[model samples]
Target chain A: MDEFGIIATYFAPLAGDGAFGLKDDAALLPARPGQDLVITTDTITEGVDFFAFDPSADIARKALRVNLSDLAAKGAAPAHYLLNLSLPHTITPDWLAGFAAGLAQDQQEFGISLLGGDTGATDGPLTIAVTAFGFVPQGKMVRRNGARIGDAVYVTGTIGDSGGGLAIFKREKHTLNDADRNALIARYRVPQPPVGFAEGLRAIAHASVDVSDGLIADLGHVASASGVRLVVEGERVPLSQPLRTLWGDHALSRAVAAGDDYQIAFTAPPGLEGPFTQIGRVEAGEGVGLIVDGKAVNVARPGYRHF
Target chain B: MDEFGIIATYFAPLAGDGAFGLKDDAALLPARPGQDLVITTDTITEGVDFFAFDPSADIARKALRVNLSDLAAKGAAPAHYLLNLSLPHTITPDWLAGFAAGLAQDQQEFGISLLGGDTGATDGPLTIAVTAFGFVPQGKMVRRNGARIGDAVYVTGTIGDSGGGLAIFKREKHTLNDADRNALIARYRVPQPPVGFAEGLRAIAHASVDVSDGLIADLGHVASASGVRLVVEGERVPLSQPLRTLWGDHALSRAVAAGDDYQIAFTAPPGLEGPFTQIGRVEAGEGVGLIVDGKAVNVARPGYRHF
Candidate 1:
């Protein structure tokens, strides 16, 4: 069958819930009345962001999860997405079938159907681009610039596990036991963004951002945007058992600066919070820093570098 | 410098008219009253879409034009764009400067600013993912499903030139004189999209499509969408001098199937005037076909295949 025929047979059925599926020139999903639409796009590259030699299902899940995490940062629910998928010429029919199954499973989990997008074969490495759009109520969207001084710094779920998980998966110069190793590996393979928790905090949290990069690195984004000092308490930073068992000396720095955690790091005023575990406090200072046991520690490294 | 700093230094300073520029979580542009927004995205790969050694400015222009052509097909005016650019680690400082300049130049020409997107470097081939947005008044937007059985077929500008140009440039088997070579090479390098003509036809055209693929293939899109058959007069298909000179006996078939022409191919009633040239008429049938002096031609090709 032709490419269009294949798309119509397999993909078109999944897109029926969309206002304009694969039929129109572009998808036009109607926004809920009195709501603002939130859009975010992320592209995954082979060897850089992911690898084909690895388990394809894991790669696909990570791709879908990372994009979903972006929406979670906005405290928005999953709605629909556009997938621009490119494949290397070496891709076989079986690979495509597996890839499509991965996508179907993710769509089922996230409750977002494919609206419309493009497909092409390239001679380069595999690349996947996904743009997820969701609806958020007017004046209720949490931004990175709404943090206030004296706000309690909060984070849902633990961090540094994914970074440690990556270290174990890559088999780099790291030491972690099997139980700790497996836990980290799962985090690396699938960083679940706390979508429900994010939605639950919409009315409480002042500002939020997802921890794709490390804790200190991503907080810098909020601090810079909100124009306030974020002084994270060293003990307030959460570290996993695997991280404790792994790097004894560098654990704090790694836990604070390692990325790909996929957890939500947010801020709320001192005592008016429903959810969110108290970690530290936003304060009047210059930029972003960590106060470990009442002393400022030098941030030697920030986080993962995309370049 | 970091990713954010690099953008602030080189790219952000160049984007003066963007909705939110580089400061927000997402760029918000207000859609015009009484008009609907049209959006499309295309990713250009190094070896698949263009040669890696090509001029960066030319590549940028081609990337922007491809998405703009999609908007032009819907009779929309260019508004803004988002770019997710990936590069190899081998880029020099000088090359980065040139690429930034090229983007700045095109942003000025199209009256669009780079809103917000991610950029990273990897070991993979260069990939440029551009999403362009345009606007057209509601209910006045042209689509692929408006063709009627008695309407005349029309096409703006020339065809078959880009395909011929590619052949000459890539295949050293052919040689050309300086003037002819320049014209053919220009056609391949920068095929002009009929944006102004599309806007002019808003009142007259029943249906329209930008002829990225050759005539017969694009016409098939209309036939499938609108459920009407179209018969093209083979001799009436437009061709440039170089294309006519290059293919000779096979010129008609080549013109009908060659892709990347990027001209506008539309359909309207016989009595319509402005922004369109008569080629043939729509007929009552199931599929699109070509006729020459009342005789059918068995042309077996349909546009360029990405595979």
Candidate 2:
């Protein structure tokens, strides 16, 4: 597909969110009566985060979806976005068409729009960076620094499916049959980001962040910001069957350490509760720890880092 | 240097525009007492735009500045920006340190702060893309479609120095000394964008755009947008002494035809005046033309296209 066609096919659906979506030089996000705007951007590269032989549509969907996950952390609804895509020379027209179609489908599903983007042919590896825009009430955007002592930490969706999925794809030499393997493989390709899940918790969550950098690492950010120790209970740590089968007892540990989860890990005061799984709680401190069987685990390394 | 230092030195100064600047998580721009917000983003890449081996500090500064130039075109000033950087492993620490220092310096100069950014290592070439934010009064943002018939076309600063300089640098045979050559190289390497010039015309110019693409090509965008013919006087085109001395008689012509000037070229009513060069005037109906010796001359191959 041509560039415009690809954009029209894929991004137009998402542009439905913007009052002046992709048609203008900039998206016209009408301020919600008495609210302010919140914006953020994230870029993902092939070799640094994924592989070249990746499923293009799935990857494209995941790229834009994670940005939404970031907004969800702020308790903001999907609005509009600017997507800048740098594609490798080897990428074909059909691939771009398919990728855009997938991205369009995600946009329609998430109720966001593609306002504008810069696309170019590159000799380097594939890269996609999306800058998302969302709006919330004047004082409602959640942040890492909002967690308080005695707050309970919650997460949407089972953690580490993405990481475990990767193992399943890599370790085909193991005991996974075709159907089980494909399901897990799909998980690796496209993360079912808890956009709705996070949205539901917004009414109850006091502070939140998307688990992009893995549970331990991202939770550490919230703890450091809020000046509290997030003591995650090992027993409450969510896990998928594939993850358990792939890494055995180390499954939950891998989930905590694995990056690119894009699930929402949030916090609320001890007495408050809502649409999330309680995996941890906050204590008066300045670091994060993992608790197992009433004993704190000696966790030195937190998780994966981009740098 | 590492990433932090580069941002500190070159980009920190230019984070704001004599106002809120980049001090907050997001720029707290006062929207005309009661107005909506308009935002946009643009990113540049090596190979696609410039070479990586070139002085990276200069590259970092221009990458950040050019994106801000887009905001200026909208009659908006810098607030905050999201930087998405893709780097090849080949970039040395010394190179990156200098780059970050340049970014920090510019951040201070431009009066913006780094709200957030995504950084990653790529097997691909070095790429830097920034999405800058700015706010406009309810109906005060100037757009490309605002040009009107009989409006005067003005250009700030000189053109061709940048494009001509690049041409001179690429020459296999050259005679200029380092100092002379450095001046020419500076135009291509570290363009002094007329961000200040934009503010001066904010109240006067009806339609404007930064001359990132050549003047003719950029003006073509306005012409197409406003549904008018933009006739630009070739001789009135500005040219630096270095460009004139380096290229002689064809200097202005080359500047008019060449792109990537980064100067502001805009249209306003004939009676409306400012400290701008009257390069041409907007005419009635649909195409862009170049005037030389009072006659229409063909302006071939408009500007640079990334695709």
Candidate 3:
């Protein structure tokens, strides 16, 4: 089938009312008064972002979830998304079917819909890019530069499961049980970006960032942007039960620096440690420091860097 | 350099105030009250969209112009854009400099700004995807389904120069002069999407589309969407001087079926054909037809298809 047929049959059902049934040259998204739109784009390529043989459904979900994590970090409500797919001729109809199904499930789960997109043939590995838009009250977006001195640093959800999953995927040896191994891998494949807590975060977060490039690197961004230092009590950093059980002695240290945890790390005033863990404190200094056993421990590398 | 450093050094200067200096995970765009947002995305890959050795600047310009053409067709004012770049390890700092220069040139020429985007390393060929946003009056977006019977069909600029350019790029034989060859290739490399005329078109056009997948295929889209037949007077289709000089006998027919013109095709009342060539007419029928020398001409294939 041709590009048009592929879009109409497999992808059009995922489009929302504004997409014009994917027939028009562009899509219309009504501008909401008194709201600011949050926009972010991310591209994931096969071999670099995921394995070529991975399930197409998971690949689709990963592309969307990573962008969704950005919106969640900014304290915005999910609105719409545009997808750009560069596919190899080797792609099969079954693969597209699974891909569309994955997007369909997420559209329902996130209350957002496909607005418009483009698809074309590529001679290289498959690449998928998503541009997601969200809405927040005007001037109310939680940024990365608001962390003040003495602010308490907080994080939501457990960290480092995805990193453990990546180690297993690379054939690293571990005594992780079957259930724990599968769970870790699943976390890597499909990140549950904490979209549910964005609204609540707007009122409390002094500064925020979604932990994709490891907790240390992401907090480093917060520190560098806010001109304040972040001191993490490494022992207090939350970890999943499975991660704690499998990752021997250096679990907390490694997990703190390992990336792909889509949890939100933020700073808020004292006496407002709501439902998240208070892992660190904001201080008047430069760079990030980790405290372990009441001693300042040094981290060799902070997180992933794309160059 | 890491991704953040690269963005700060090169891409950050191109970002507008809404981008927050490229430090935030997401950018904010204020919604204009009483307006609707128009969104479109296009992805171009190395070796597929352009020759691998083509100037990085031209590739970047083409990527943005193609999506800008979509917004022009929809009669919307260009506002902001997000870019997603997946670069192979082979990409050099010089290449990125040229690429960013290209985007910076067009961002100023088009009066749009970079908002927020993603850049990552890829194991495959270089890929660039851009999502552009535009604004139109709340309910006045020019659509593809509003053509009326007896309306005159018009196209902006000239067609077939890009086709001639592609032919020469493929090393095809042509007796054209050197200057003409260069001009044709330039047309193919950089499309000047008629964004300035969009506001006027919004008030006068009944239906509109950008001619990307050839005049015939794109007109077929308007016809199918509008539930009407379009008959093109092939002899009347405008051609650039270089195209006319280089293309011999089957010029009109071939140009109509060649893709990537990036010109606007719209339907308007006969009295409202202001500044564009009247190439066809909308009638009470189905599909699209071409008339040459007072005789019906059959086109075996309407346009390029990616399958």
> What is the C-alpha lDDT profile of model 1 across B285-305, one tens digit per residue?
767888977898876868866
- Across all models, the iRMS values in order are 2.7, 3.7, 1.2
Tell me the tens digit of each residue's lDDT in model 2 across A56-131. Answer: 7877887887788787777777667788988776788777767877787887788776777767777887889988
Give the alpha carbon lDDT tens digit for every residue of A14-118 in model 1.
684532547655544432556656666777878666657756677777877777887787777777777677777787676666666777888888888887777
Encode model 2's per-residue lDDT on B1-307: one tens digit a residue.
4433444454454444311222212222222344545566667778656776688788888787777777777677666677788877677778877877777778778776666666677777888888776666667777787898889898888888778768875792287666656787787777676666545666888888778778887888789778888998888887777787777777766787777777788898775556568888888877788878888888677677555
What tens-digit string does per-residue lDDT give for candidate 3 at A1-307? 8999999998899889799999999999898889999988888778766787888899999999999999999999998999999898999999999999999989989999998898888878888998898999999999999999999999988899888888888887568889998888888888888899999899999999999999999999999999999999988899987777767787898799888888899999866756689999999998899999999988887798886
TM-score of chain B of each: 0.92, 0.87, 0.97
Q: How does residue A181 of candidate 1 score in lDDT?
A: 81
What TM-score against the true fold does each predicted structure earn? 0.92, 0.90, 0.98
Q: In terms of DockQ, which candidate is stronger, 2 or 3? A: 3
Candidate 1 residue A214 Cα shift, in angstroms, is: 1.8
TM-score quality measure for candidate 3: 0.98
Of the true interface contacts, what fraction does each candidate have?
Answer: 0.19, 0.35, 0.89
Q: Each prediction's DockQ?
A: 0.38, 0.40, 0.82
Query: What lDDT score belongs to each candidate, Candidate 1 first?
Result: 0.74, 0.72, 0.89
Regions more than 4 Å wrong, model 1:
A1-6, A16-20, A30-33, A173-179, A246-249, A272-275, B14-19, B29-33, B172-174
**What CA RMSD would you report for each candidate?**
2.7, 3.5, 1.3
- The DockQ leader among the candidates is 3
